[model samples]
Target: MKLLVLFSLFFVLCSVESLKVLVLFHMPVKSLSILGTGVVRHLLNAGHEVTYVTVYPLKNPPTKNFRQIDISKNVELVANDETLTMGYVLEHQIEKNGAYQIQVFSQENARQTFQNENLKKLIQDPNEHFDVVFSDLLESEVYSGLAVLYDCPMIWLYSMGAHWQVLRLIDHGTNPAFTPDYLSPNDLPLSLFERVEELWARIRWQFLKTFITQPEERKIYEETFGPLLAQRGRTLPDYEEVMYNASLIFANEHHAIRDRPATPQNFKYVGGFHIEDPVQPLPKHFQDLIENSKHGVIYFSMGSFLKSNSLPKKLVQELLNMFGQLKQTVIWKFETTLPDVPKNVHIVHWAPQPSILAHPNVKIFITHGGLLSSMEAIHFGVPIIGVPVFFDQFTNINKAVINGYALRVNLNYDLPKGLSAAIDVMLNDDRYSKKVKEMSAIYHDSLTKPGDEIVHWVEHVVRTRGARHLRSPAFNVPLYQRLYLDVLAIILAAVYLVKYIIASFDTKKAKKQSQKKKN
Candidate 1:
């Protein structure tokens, strides 16, 4: 019994050995940072030492094991630029200019990140080591070099749903026929025209990637990581190889909320990982306003990237006038104060979005249809009116509309009447609320909480030393072989040979008949 007890204790200690984790999540968006912080928090709770590189640092470090390398100034230089804002996106429709603009911005951001003094120090330190590295799978692939620097496995964290760009790294690209591109405004069961459009969109993106994006990214990759790799006496691998070599990817997606695609074993869905458990109570003023409201409330916010004050003055007045007609109290997340505000319309420079969605008196949510907001609405069982502005917002809102939980409103000067009509439908019809509640139940029915799943998988990769067994075999197969082009070539050659031989025989027979007739 003494020997058995000792063995059990030994196993326990072995299983819980603290791991050194390095995290890089430098995206300027606050929502993406929320997901990254959640990951850092869970790793710290599991007794792991973490070195986090982020734009949004924690106000107070959670523990001594947690260390942050602040890169907010570097990211802000790119993020605060006016050309990348929501107003710019709306002016130049995403189909034409938004994607290219974002790519350019991401390239500049990557350059700035490599130049950050603190990040440079960390990379140059001879004593720095980590058991694993977690990096954001945004447009830039320069950070993957850190995994190579530490000689540890890399895992990618995607801030949105399963996109073809991310999936192509793990497995074959998703078929554009059925799976819409991330920027596409259409969904499944697509019409013939939609499929053609989707295919063209994909081809155009691939063309841009091959001709424009990849070359620039490769240059940055070599310029930033070349010295570090040379110090280690190793030549850099191909940029494609480095980007596609991740051991696993944790996508902010769930089959419950989105359609399930053919994902590989390495692609794990852990959506809503940022939502706090035992959600904190609202502040006194917010609680009082929500609880004391005579009529239910309607919440409006365009998310962090788009400022409500950026709207045209005429449209703003139209919205105010529309809100004045509503009997329900309106809570708008505007960035600045406006004059002549309606008594029922309350304007807050900032609002606690999740807390507001959780309130029982909140009847409807009018949003910009960001994935994070859509997920939150579904999480709290609140139906929404989505006003998608750009990027994946169109796709996310379309999914909600197809799922019967949300209505979409175009962002235009004439949004007031349209928004009011959608609000009426939401308030009068119970179907949207009931459908959203059902989705909420599904979102909550997972076997393990998102936080637990994150920790388990992160440790799993570290314990298994990259977990290569989980990777798809498709990675090893060449495109020609996978498409059976060689087999098709062989069959075509055999058919041509048979036809040639038959033609020769027929000619000989015809000549023999001619000789007999002459004789």
Candidate 2:
């Protein structure tokens, strides 16, 4: 009895020593905010204490065990953030002028977020200590200084597939022949022209980063975070070193959507962690509408970041008119009500999108092809009519179309006509629905829930003190060495030396032959 009592006490003590984690995610978009919150929720549920630094605060703050350093005011710094219209997106393709825009936006946000007086105060407080730091892997790598300051292992939570830039932090350069850039709209098994373009884009991005982007980012880091780290008696690590120090990268991607190159051991695919089990039931009125729809329902949402109402008023009217004529009950997620509503069309300012997708009556989803929305649609086995807009949406929708579960309609002035045709093809064709269900089964066949898997990895990193063995040594190797250029140079030099020796022997033999002839 005494032995059993001692064992029980030991177990209780072990359980109480949960990790103290620090999370820094300030992106204010609702979907990303939800994803970040989901990570926090899992850590809290696993009995870990978390200090979350974010721009979007929890509506119902945790009563205990969670502390929030809210810099919610930073959201205002991003202009027209709430109104990412289709027109705006199509006009600014990421490959063209969009990459620059993304860089500017990321730096601005990072500047505002990391430079906040309150955040600096938190950093200055020597009393605070943490076991690990988890950060959203954004375009800005400046925030990585947090891991350096805390002297803890860092885990990057990427809300998209492994981009070439993120891969650089973990391993070596990704092959452009097979791995498409995130901003690229091309699907794999790409044509020769597409491959050339992808290769050029990759090269151009690398050049831009090395020459222009990194220098600008370094300045921001020095101006803002450098002084803060110095004050804490922590020497700031070189910007590149801090990036390579990430212990693990949790990418929000899976093979169900698109196949990717072989990843390093430290990368985890936790794509659908945002999905809720036993999805919350829809509101009574919304449930009634879905249930009563005789001709099936078409759910339309441009995701949380892009507002459907932000479309040109004329375009909105045209869409309403087009939906009015359709036999299907159209459920559009508009941020505000239209002055006149069609009898067949339903407009809700905010949507319970996953719940709507899960409905048996929801036959097709018209979406902007955000990764989270794409994952949910696949999870619920719903076919999609993807109207791809800015950023990774084009790439996502292209993959879906290639995967046989979706049809793509570009956002243009003729959107209504294009969307109508795409919708007809998706609904009337049985192949789309059948294919998505098959993919859904594969997605659901994972060994554990994505959230649980993420939790397990987070705990693993904390317990193992950064899990350095899991990280790729390629991160430490120089680019020239990784490509074997030095070896090639050595081989060429040896060949030249052998050629020189042979020529010298031939010259000596010729001179002896001349002397013999003269004698």
lDDT of 2 by residue, 127-190 (tens): 8888999988777788777787778889999989877878888898689988888888878898
Per-residue CA lDDT of candidate 1, range 1-519, in tens?
A: 999999999999897889999988877777788788889988888889999999988898776798999988765664556655656655654433345656666777888888889899999887899999998877667778888889899999988777887888889988888888777788778999999988888887777777887788899889878888898789988888898889999998776865757899999988888788867789999999888888899999998877787677778889999999999999999989999999999999988888888998998999988878888898899999999887788888889998999999887656898998999999999999999999999999989988889899999998999999999999789989999999999999999999989999999999999999999
TM agreement with the true structure for every prediction: 0.94, 0.94
- Least accurate stretch of 10 residues (summed lDDT) in model 1? 90-99
Best by lDDT: 1
Least accurate 10 contiguous residues by lDDT in model 2: 89-98
* Model 1 clashing residue pairs (backbone): none
| Candidate 1, residue 484: lDDT | 99
How many residue-pair clashes does candidate 1 contain? Answer: 0
User: How much is 2 displaced in model 2, in angstroms?
Assistant: 11
What is the RMSD of candidate 1?
Answer: 2.4
**lDDT of predicted model 2:** 0.84
